[model samples]
Target: MHVTFPGRHGADPARAVDGVDLDIRPGEIVALVGESGCGKTTLARSLLGLVPPTAGRVTFGGKPLGYSSRALKAYRKRVQLVLQDPSGSLNPRHTVYDAVAEGLRIHGYGGDEQEAVAQALSRAGLRPPERFFLRYPHELSGGQRQRVVIAGALVLEPELIVADEPVASLDASVRGEILALLLRLRAELGLSALVVTHDLGLAWNIADRVAVMYLGRIVETGEVERVLTAPQHPYTRALLSVLPEAPGDPVVLTGEPPDPSRIPSGCRFHARCQILASGEAERAGVADACRGEDLPLLDGGGRAQVACHWARAVRT
Candidate 1:
C-alpha cells in the first residue's frame, strides 16, 4: 500500500510508503527490516489503520480495510500495536490489572473482565498473575514492563500484533526472554505478527519471513533462511554485512539516504548501492538500467525476489 504526505511548503510530497505490498499469514511472523527513516513504521501504521494510504489499499482477510470509526474500532480489536518502549506504553498511574483490562473496557467486552485480564497476563509470561495486579509501572523491571505491554495487547485476544522494535529498549539479557515470549504467544494462540525492526538478528530469531525495505519500497523478500544466508538485493547485503557476525569488512554505504520527497530516478537504492559502486552492475550489463530504469515491486511472496536491475541481470 502507498502512504504519501503533503510536502513542507512547495516541495514535492514525502512518499513515506510508496507502492509496498506485504502479507502476513496466520501463525507466522514477518519482520520488516530497514533503516530508521525507510518507512517501516508508516507501513505498520497503515496496516493498523492509523494512517490511510494515499494511493493503495490495505486488505485484511481478503477485504479492504475501512476508515470509519466503527470499522477501525472493530479492526483494532483483531490487530494491536506493541510499541518500542514499554515505559512510554504503560501509564505510571495505572496498575498491571487496569492496564491489561483497558482494551476490554474500550471494546466493551461482555466476558468476565477479571478472568480475561488474568489469562492475558499469564499468556504474556507474568506467572501468578494475581500477585502483580496491584503493581504499577515503576515497580516492574524493564522486561516486566514490556510483558505488561504484551499483556495489554493480548487482553483483547488480537489475531495480529504489530510490534515496532518490541525489545529495542530492553537489556541484552532480557531481549531473548521477550523474543521467546512472542514466539510462545504465536505458538499457543495461533497469532500472526508483523515485526518491524532494523536488527537482522531479531528477524533471524523470530520471523519465518523477512522483507527488506529501502526508501519507501520493499527491495527484497523471502524466507528468513534464504534471504539472510544468500541475499540478492544490494541494500539487504549491505545491512547483513554490518552484522557483528558478518565476515570480513562491512560494506559501508556511501552518501546519505535519498530523501523521499525527491526519490531518484530508476532504483531508489541505486544512489548508494555497493554493487553499482563496485562496477558489478556494469559487469552484468545493467549499469544503465540501474541508473535509468525503475524495477518492479518485489511483492512479498513464497519465492525470493529482489528489485534490482543488476541482480536481475546476474541471476538471469
Candidate 2:
C-alpha cells in the first residue's frame, strides 16, 4: 500500500499521516510502532478504507481498491478490525452471542449460529462458551469483553486483522492472556495481522517484522530482530532508548518531539535527531537548515528500509 497526503491537514493543521508505503503479506504479522499521532492508527484505518488518502493507492490481492462503497464492503469482509476498547466497540445492548454472530449474519453465512458462536468463544479463550453467550458487554470484565470483541472479528475468518492497541486498556496480568489468544488464532487460522502499538517490547514479542513511523511516515522498517536490536533511523533509536531496561541504563534523548503542525522542515526528525545533523548550525540549532531538505526513504543494509540521509553514519 502506498499512501500520501497532498497538502493534507490533520486535527492540528499538519498532515498526521504523511506519505507512507507498506505491505502486509499473508500469514505474516507486521507491527506498526510509534508515538501517538504518528499515524499508526491512520495507516491501519486507510487499509480498512476508513481514512482516504489524498494522493495514493491501496492494492489488495493485486487489485486497486478505493474507498468506494462496493470496494469498501468487500475489503471489510476480508479485512476485519479489532478496536482498542471492547466497551466502545461492542454494542452494550447486544449479548456476547449477538456480537459474535453479527459478522456471520452480515457476510451472509447461513450456517449454524450456535456452532459458530461456540467456536468463536473457544478461539477467544472464552471457553465454557455457554457462560458468555448470554452476558452483555457491561456485565463482563474488561479482559472478557475484549475477548468478545476478538471473537466477533475471528468469527468472520478474515484474511487480515488490524488490531489497533487491542490490549492497551486491559490490566497487565490479563494482557498476556489476550496476546496469547491472538497468537493462537493466527496459528489456527493462518491469518495475517497488523498490530498497531507504541510498545516496542510488545512488538518484539509478537511481530515478524516491525515498521517504525514518525511524523506520519515510516522511518525504519525491517525484520523485527534487526530493527529493534540495531535501529537505523535516529528516531527509532530515541524510541528504543525510552524502553524499560536493565539496572544502570544510560539516559537517552533529551526532550519530547516537535509540534506536528509546525513540523521541522527537511527531515521531520532532524530537530530531535542527535546523530543526523550535529555540526550544521542551521540543522542543529533552531535556525532551521534541516527544514528545507527532503530525504528519500532509502533501502539500507540487512533488507531494512530507512528514511534518513545520515542513516549510513548512524548504522556504522
Candidate 3:
C-alpha cells in the first residue's frame, strides 16, 4: 500500500505519510521502524481505514480499499488492528468476554458466540478462557489486558493484523511473552502482520523484514538481520549504533531530525547524516549529488533496498 496524509495546516508537514510504498507478503511479518512522529502509526492506520490517505492508494487482496460503510466493514474483518495501549483501547466496563465477543457481535456472528469468544481468548493465551470471561479490564494484568486486545482482533479471524507498538507499554519481561504470542499465532494461523514500532530490538525479535522510516519516507528496507546488522542508509545506521549490543563506536546523530514542515531540499536526511558530513562522500566525489539531488530507494539486488547516494555508490 502507498499512503500519504495532507498537512495539518499550511505551515505543518505536508504529508504525514509521504509516498511510502510497502508490501507485506502473505504470512510475512514486516516491521515499520522510525523515531516518534515519523508517520509509522499514520501508515498503519491507513491500512485499517482509520486514517484516510490524502494521496496514493491502498489495495488489499488485489482490490482498492473502499470508504463506504459496507466496504469498510468487510475490509476491517479481513484486516484487524492491535493498538499500542490496551488500557486506552479497551472499555473499562467491558468484561474480557465482551471485549472479544464485541467483534463477533459487530460482524453478526450467528453461531455459538460463547464458543467463538472462548476460542479467541484461548488462542491469545488467556488460559482457562472461561475463568476470565467476567473479569473487567482493571482486573487483568498489563500482559493479560494486552492479550485481551489481541483476542478481540482474533475473534474476526482476520488474515492480516496491523500491530502499532504492540508491546511498547508493557514491562520488559512481558514484552517477550507478547511477541512470542504473536509469533505463535502467526505460525499457527498463517497471519500476516505489519508491526509499527520505534523499538529496533522488537524488529530483531519478531519481524522477517524491516523498513526504516525517516521524516515520512522509507529510508531503508531489507531482511531483518541485514537491515539491523548492516544498515545501508545513514539514518538507519545511526538508529542501530545506539543499540546496547551494537559493536564498535556508535554513530551519534548530531541534531534532531528536521521538522517535517520545513524538510530540507535534496536528501531529507543530509543535514543530520554523518556520511554526508564525514568527507567520505567528498573523497568518493559524490558530495554534490548528496546535497543537490533527492535519492530514491534503489534495489541492490541483494537483501536490501536503500535510499542514500553514498550507500548506493559504495554498494555498486
Candidate 4:
C-alpha cells in the first residue's frame, strides 16, 4: 500500500508514508517494526481500506480496493483486525460467547451459533470452551481477554489478520501463550498476518518477514533472518542494538532515530547514525553513505528487499 499526505490533518504533513509497498502471502506472517509514531498502524489500516491513501492504491489478489459499502463489507469479511487492548474491543456487558458469535451474526452465517463459538474459542486456545463462554470482558484475565479478541477475529474466518501488538499488555508469562496461539492459528487456518509491533523480540519470534519503518517511511524490509542478522538501514540497526541479546554475539547499535515531523533531508536517519560519521570512515560505514540520495528498494537475496545504498557491504 502507498500513502502520502496532501497536507497535515491529524498526522503531520511532513511525516507521511511514501511508496510503502509490501505484501503477505498465504500462511506467512510479516512483522512491521518501528518506534512509536512511525505510521506502522496507519499502513496496516490502509491495507484493510480503513485508512484512505492520498497517492496510491492497495490491491488484494490483483484487485484494487474500493471503500464503498459493498467493497467494505467484502473486505471486512476477508480481513480481520485484533487490537492491542481487549477491553477496548470487547463490550463489558457481552459474554465471551456473544462476543465470539457477533461476527457470524453480522455476516448472516446460517449455522449453529453455539458450535461456531465453541470452535472459535478452541482455536484461540481458550480450552474447555464452557469455561469462557459465559465470562464477561472484565471477568477474564488479560491473556484470556486477548484470546477472546483473537477468537472474535477467527469466528469470521478471515483470510488475513492484522494484529496490532496482540500481547503488549499481558503479563510476561502469558505473552508466550498468546504468541503461540497466533502461530498455531496461522498454521491451522492458512492465514496471512501483518502484525504491527514495536518489540523486536516479537518479530524475531514470530515473523517470516520484517519491515522496518522510520519517520513514516519504510527504510528496510527482508526475510527475518537476514534483516535481524545483518540490518541494512541505520535506523533498523539502531533499534536492534538496544534490544536484549545473548552474550556470545552482542551487537550494539548507536544513537536515537530522528523524529517524524522534523525529518532530515535526503535520509531521515543521518542525524543519529554512527555509520555516517565523517572522521571514522572516508566512505560510509557498513550500512552508511547515500546521505544525500534517496534509496529505493534493492534486492538483497532470498526475496529480501532493503532500502540502503550501502546495504550490500553491510550484509557482507
Query: TM-score of each candidate?
Result: 0.99, 0.88, 0.95, 0.89
| Model 1, residue 63: C-alpha shift (Å) | 1.2
lDDT of 3 by residue, 1-316 (tens): 3444446555564567776888888999999999999888888888888888877778898899999999999999999999999999999998899989999989998899999999999999998999999999999899999999999999999999999999999999899999999999999999999999998999999999999998888889999998998888888888888889988888988888777667777888888889878898887777888888987643322357888888878988
**Where does candidate 3 stray beyond 4 Å?**
1-9, 297-303
Regions more than 4 Å wrong, model 4: 5-12, 246-262, 278-281, 285-289, 298-302, 313-316
Give the alpha carbon lDDT tens digit for every residue of 107-189 in model 2: 78888988988998998899899888999998999999999998899887789999999899999999998888888888989
User: Candidate 1 lDDT, tens digit per residue, 122-228?
Assistant: 99999999999999999999999999999999999999999999999999999999999999999999999999999999999999999999899999999999999
- The residue-level lDDT of candidate 2 at 50 comes to 85
Ranking by lDDT: 1, 3, 2, 4
- Predicted structure with the largest TM-score when compared to the true one: 1
Residues forming the 10-long window of minimal summed lDDT in candidate 4? 279-288
lDDT of 4 by residue, 236-278 (tens): 7767877768333344434555655566665666666566654
Off by over 4 Å in 1: none
Assess each prediction's global lDDT (C-alpha) against the native.
0.93, 0.81, 0.88, 0.80
Candidate 3: minimum summed lDDT over ten consecutive residues — where?
Answer: 1-10
Q: Which ten residues in a row have the lowest lDDT in candidate 2?
A: 280-289
Return the clash pairs for model 3, or none: none
| Clash-forming residue pairs, model 2 | 265-291, 266-291, 282-289
